[model samples]
Target: MSEQIETWGDLVERAGVGIGGTPSDAPVTKLISAPIPITGSDGTKDFGGCGSGCGCMPQA
Candidate 1:
């Protein structure tokens, strides 16, 4: 009486293993187009620079 679900369709078909009767609302996530803009000097900053010390701008 044990089963393993491997796909979305299988998940929707199974009952009792989950809420047993109905689907519940899932949380939502909103992504940003770009990294949030940093304002002025945030005091501490990430100086993560290209490991290349060739003095040229790294190809982001």
Candidate 2:
């Protein structure tokens, strides 16, 4: 006989589709602050201005 599914969590559990990481194993403490530099490149790009000739302007 087939198993009965009551909720989405039950369906996912029955399918056995997961990476095997529980809530307790989550990297909650590994989070970083906004001031942390992710890359070596300094975000100081001066895009002059978004004039009609600017290619960066969204075409709408």
The candidate maximizing TM-score is 2
| Candidate No. with top lDDT | 2
Which residue pairs in candidate 2 collide?
Answer: none
- Residues 1-60 of candidate 1 have per-residue lDDT tens digits of 346555444555554355444444432233333343322345444533334543322335
In model 1, the Cα lDDT at residue 46 comes to 51
Distance (Å) between predicted and true CA of 6, model 1?
Answer: 0.2
Q: Where's the lowest-lDDT run of ten residues in candidate 2?
A: 27-36
**Cα deviation in Å at residue 23, candidate 2?**
14
Q: lDDT per model, in order?
A: 0.41, 0.44
lDDT of 2 by residue, 1-60 (tens): 345555445555667876354542333232223333323345644433345644443334
lDDT score for candidate 1 against the true structure: 0.41
